[model samples]
Target chain A: MPIAITDPDDPRIEPYRAVRERDLVGRQHRFIAEGEVVLRVLLKQPRFEIESLLLAENRLDGLSDALEDLPPDVPVYTANRQVMDAIVGFPIHRGILAVARRAPLLPLEEFLTALPEDALVVGLVGLANHDNVGGIFRNAAAFGAQGVLLDHESCDPLYRKAIRVSVGGALVVPFTRAPSAEAMVQALQAASFEIIALSPAGSEILSRVKPARRTALLLGAEGPGLPRELLARSRTVSIPMSGGFDSLNVATTSGIALHHLTSQKDEKPLPR
Target chain B: MPIAITDPDDPRIEPYRAVRERDLVGRQHRFIAEGEVVLRVLLKQPRFEIESLLLAENRLDGLSDALEDLPPDVPVYTANRQVMDAIVGFPIHRGILAVARRAPLLPLEEFLTALPEDALVVGLVGLANHDNVGGIFRNAAAFGAQGVLLDHESCDPLYRKAIRVSVGGALVVPFTRAPSAEAMVQALQAASFEIIALSPAGSEILSRVKPARRTALLLGAEGPGLPRELLARSRTVSIPMSGGFDSLNVATTSGIALHHLTSQKDEKPLPR
Candidate 1:
């Protein structure tokens, strides 16, 4: 049964208070899932445990279907729009927010070993922007890429804005952060994954490169690109662009690269 | 000679004051170009006139080549970091900002008529988000699409943030706003361009479809997608995706769609 909460000061609702001051996800293992769309994605994933739900009274009716299936012990707290705003310290237009605890993170080596022999993966280096991280995960999920590997310099995928930008892809796609770009590359090489570094100066154009059975695309931060040593060690490729234009955004680059590498001959859509 | 101003409230710099309170771009025919990269692009574009440049004292030395080529009448203003922040109402971290006036927008019909016989173009419907609009233009430029036709409901591509997000592609690509999506579709058909409507429910897969000599992709806003009437009138195409995943971001969708449709058999980079 859904709980009716009238007080904005209710201790049970404390986790959601003043979200802008500091992200609850960073401070604790609990992360916020905003909007009905993200909450729905969270409901479907078993890896995360739903801590509770805080919903506007007006929004409850619209999300009855999602609420009905939630485990009985999971508390569904409802507040009027004003009280909800007061509790959260701002207007949350989405009106539906869920707090969920993150599952145990997989180590880089262990995660690499689990992939299938012909799996497609993306490796990100020095990608400090949260939105880019989330966008990459969303793209990864769309094309059925197995997982992503992030170096230490990358932003946390579970950051609140990243999760919202990805439409909850940060929750669905499997990812692990490594100590450094060098370490991440070494692990993939040991796992027998072909490393193709994407660079503006890369000799091979993206369209012409044929991926090996197990392939990992190496992407770097928007401006600096991949470190020279990394690019030199791997097979380097570039997206052919019209002359005089800057390179694509980091996330957009991943989408284009993944689309080419993951698309099969005869061009059939990958099964979920 | 560069004009040096130490006072934050100088009437000479009034056009740049309190940028966050009200965007000067929307208020007037003017827009802002931020950072070194965008400024460089703006310099190359003949259409947008550089009204004035506000550069931090530290940055002027590095931009010697750009400043050398500027017309003598165009004022180059230099300020210290603190004074620069006071003028723009923000940190102005990139240390480079320029004010540029938009060129007169071409009429929708006239712009469409101007494209080459074999040109590829993109038509956007009800895309109100500036980032998405900017991103689409960036992708369009990458593949050498001739121009974009936006409906009345779309945001202005010349809006300040859109230009910055586009990395100034909004300046480079020729675009015009039409009164309605239906009207835009008719114009493309009249111009003898094959219209391909991209939709999640599209019947034909994008990869298998061979584009005509003159092809224009019609894309709608993310959630509602293209109107059924528009879809019926045009040949619909879908990007094959892994099942259970939501459709890609509209911008990412454009990038993938344009990449596949625009790549030539010989795989040469599209000429600018």
Candidate 2:
């Protein structure tokens, strides 16, 4: 049964209050999942623990299918549009939201060791934009990149807007953070991963590069791109562009690179 | 010489007033260009006519190099950040803005006929989001897609947000709107262009499909992809994905598709 939340100030739904402001501040150990698609992904993924759900009363019937499998202890609160809007401090037309606790993160070394011998992953360095982070995760999921490794300077893929832009990819794809870009490269190299850093001045073009059994495509923020040291350390490849124009959005670059790296002619079927 | 304006309500800069509000309504025959990168492209491209420029006084030094070649008759207006923000009804942090006349749009038929014998282009259908439209344009420009064609249901690529997101690709790339998707397809067919529609249910994987001398990679919005009839009418291809995931941000799809379509072993270099 769904509990009715008539009062906007209800303490049971306290965590959902002032969403935009809370987004700027941290979500502590908990994060928000928004919209129908993301809520479905959260419900289906066992790694994330659902704390509760808040939905516009009218959205109840539509989400009944998703709510059927909800654990009894996890509360589902229903509110009228006005109360829901007031609770979140905005008119959230999506009418669906949830709070989920973050899963315990594994150490980078341990996580890399457990990967299949023919693993493919993405390494993000200094990518601060939430949209770009989310978009890369979405691409990573589509192209079947086993995991995503982010340097400390990169923005959180779990950020609310990033998750929303990723269309639930941030939730579906397994990811971890590293202390630094150099640390990430060292870790991947130790794990027998060929780290290919993407840059405009790369020595090789993207299409011609062959992927090793274990390949990690490394990307950095646009404009500044990857640091010179990282480029020199890794096998760098560039996507050929029209003359005098050498920029592609970081997320888009990941998609093109992943598509090529993962589409090897004799590649084995990906494990579900 | 730059004119100093202390007032936000100056009628000479009326076109920039309430920019957010005006973006919702059409900009008549004119469009606003924002940021330094886009402004540079606007200045370098002869197709667009610059009516005037508005900038924050502090940004004047950085833009002096770009403005040196400015035509004497084009007015340059500078104001303090406060007045500039108030005029645009937002914090215009980039501190550069311009109102330019839209270049006359060529008919879809004429535009198709003018392309080179081995032209590579992108065709957008029902893409209503500004960010996606802009991102697609950026990819098109990066991969040397000669032109972009849009159907009637698609949003205007020249919208302010679209132009800003495109990083000025909207200004540099040639595009034209068609009355309908079928009409756009008919025009391309008439011009001897092979139309390849991108869809999840596409018969062939993207990498295997060979491109014709003149190829048009057709893409639709994320959810309700290319219409069934349109899919039936065109040769369809899909980007292979992990079993359960079929979604790729439409713009990312364009980036991957453009990279493959434009890159050919015997392809000639793009004309500047």
Candidate 3:
């Protein structure tokens, strides 16, 4: 199915091109992880549905070894450097990019019920940056947080930049878009899980987080941290910072908090 | 005094032009943080020395107020949009662009001794992205981390992108460039500060960290965490995570770890 495009204005590349238009960029509800290195990482996922792959005449990597799962039928469009530059609107060094459709949103109930008896669902609220979200996922995957839940205003977790930032951790981590903060909080409470809001205005320190059967950390963006309302609704657990400097990125906050909550089973409790 | 040039190739603006180079573009050490908005931030710092300023004809916010500082001494150049655009490689937004010499690197001793006793110093290892570094500073400032210190491999804390990502915190938070990790570790030990390395490899949880007289939470870049030698020299305290997920980002880890260590002052022993 490989289709050659002598013209950069080919209609076949609308979805990919639309990624750059301001309005469609972040709000796509899907991600465009348009790079060779990252697409290879996505290929590892069983559910990866690569819509299209555009590459230059000179092959990028060990395309033979990296993309074995491609059933010969998938399109591997070939073009010269100039054509690719025109097509992608930028010179992508690695020279191959695949437009990956967002995986179907996982069901919350299934994810909720799937957690072990004790679980900590790290919830991301207002985490708008795709790269930040992806980085958080990467850290989340590395540290073994049970799952990540995006709040109402969050950037799409599966967005392309996030995929690249997470270095493909976006594929492995079990994350779902949670409902409104109120609804998500209620659900966590209904399930008998404690909702620990990681905040700068926390009443207790993060290490002092006394885990119950389950815990869910509510993370807001780095600047305007968890909205005041979200903080008010949940039990606040602050990470005491000794440096006089203000603020850490939300992704970074989520990572430390996730690690803190997860480590409870093995050692002495940290400060709350 | 003001100087105006219609040519973008004018050697007079070499400092500004050098900023456009690949390694230095959008960088802290050389990037010219143009605009009244960004320059106003630079003016507050005793550190950011103004090299030159190009002002567009119109009156701007803070511009009306800064005339006193502009005395007959400083260079204030002027050009309309078209002319300024010709001189600058890109459209000069914010009407005003100030070219300032980067603050000289403060010695580790100067940064450490300048702080009041028991001050929190954030030592970063291998965190490269300017934005991430900037965001780390923002969070560090928010949580009152005393000062941020970058080891040799870290990005410059003053880059334009870092400044933007920090939301201006880069201009405010006090930071030092300590190029040697070993030297930094030695400095901390000399300060009688206990360096707590945050990681997932250890059994000790974050809550297990006993509040010390002076603490430095040494953080490494994501993916490859702190080197074994560094970890070996420091007390290892980890944030617990559910089995099989990845760890948190170095900046976020610093935030939570700093929060964990800073929260309570009670020396009461916790129950095992």
Candidate 4:
């Protein structure tokens, strides 16, 4: 049974207070998860420990199946719409929120070493936008990429909005933040991965280039794309665009590249 | 010369007041464009008439080149940071905004009939999420799709957030709303298009199929997907997934599909 929290000011619901404001700071390890879909993903991911759950009373019956998996000690705090709104400092119409803490990151080298020889990977450089990062993770998961590597400048994938945008693919996709963009490239190269950097000024067409046994697709933020030095070091590829429209959203670029690299060589029997 | 306005409540700046709130109710023929990038796109595009522009005082010097072509009668209102914030009822750090009116939609049949013999088109069905709709337009523009056709249930591509997310690709990519999903399909078929519906349960792998000379790629909102009747009428295609993660963002799906369909048949010269 869930615990009824009558007062918005109750200490039990303290973790959820001023959620949008708190997201900017006090993010040592914990993160806020919003809406039913994200909360469900949070509950299923074993590496993240559920700190607490705050739910609008009306949504309790609807989420009973999801709640069944919760550990008994994890407190489920229920409040009316008004009370929950007061706690979160916004109108949370989705009516479900959770607090979860991730375990420390796996070492970049160790994670890369674990990939299979024929693995496909995506490396994100200076991707400050949360939505792009989330979309990349979702694409990576869908295309069955072995993992994603993010440079230090990339936004945290665990941010509430990023997780929601990803449909919680951030939790499922194995990823690590590299020390720097240069470091990420070196690590991939050391792992014998063919590092193909995607850029508008690329020297090779993406579709024409065949993927190596171990391939890594690199992307950067939209305006100031991957650094010149990085592009110079790696095999640069461009998705040939028509109509003189050179830019495609970074996430979309990843999807197209990943699909081409993964689907062409492999013959997975797609259900007819 | 740009007009300098000091008061936030000035009638000249009326079109920019409470922008987010006004977007929902007051959208007649008018739509808002935000940020330097979108505003630049608006200025260059010949279709949408720029009603007025509200810019923070500091950004004026940076936009001289873009403003050079603005019609003399078109008022460019300049305001300080404080006044601009008050006018929009929020902190718009982008510091640039434009109000533009769209010309009446071209008839769907007329637009489809005009596409070239080897045209590639995207048909969006019941795509309620503005971000997804915008993304599809961006992808369509990048891959040189002839045009996008939207069903009645789809969000207006001119919505502020949609326009911003699309990076103004919505304005660049010609699109028209159809009466219904069935009507959109019928129009595509009448245009001699080989209709291909993308679905997770699609009958054939996307990579395996070579597109017909005149092809239309149909996508729906994430959950329900293309209506069952629509799928039955068209050749269904699927992007293969791994790790049991069947879902990909609708926008990413469009990118992958459009890239494959367009890149395969064409031999566009690659720039070194």
Question: For every model shown, what is its TM-score relative to the native structure?
Answer: 0.93, 0.97, 0.73, 0.93
By TM-score, how accurate is candidate 4? 0.93
Rank all candidate structures by their DockQ, best first, as comma-separated numbers. Answer: 2, 4, 1, 3
Best by TM-score: 2
Best by DockQ: 2
* CAPRI accuracy category, model 1: medium
What are the per-model DockQ values?
A: 0.69, 0.83, 0.44, 0.77
- Worst 10 contiguous positions by lDDT, candidate 1 chain A: A263-272
The lDDT, on a scale of 0 to 1, for candidate 1 is 0.85
2 versus 4: better DockQ goes to: 2
CAPRI band of model 3? acceptable
Worst 10 residues of 1 chain B by lDDT: B263-272
Misplaced by over 4 Å in model 4 are A268-272, B8-10, B268-272
Error of 3 at B55 (Å): 7.1
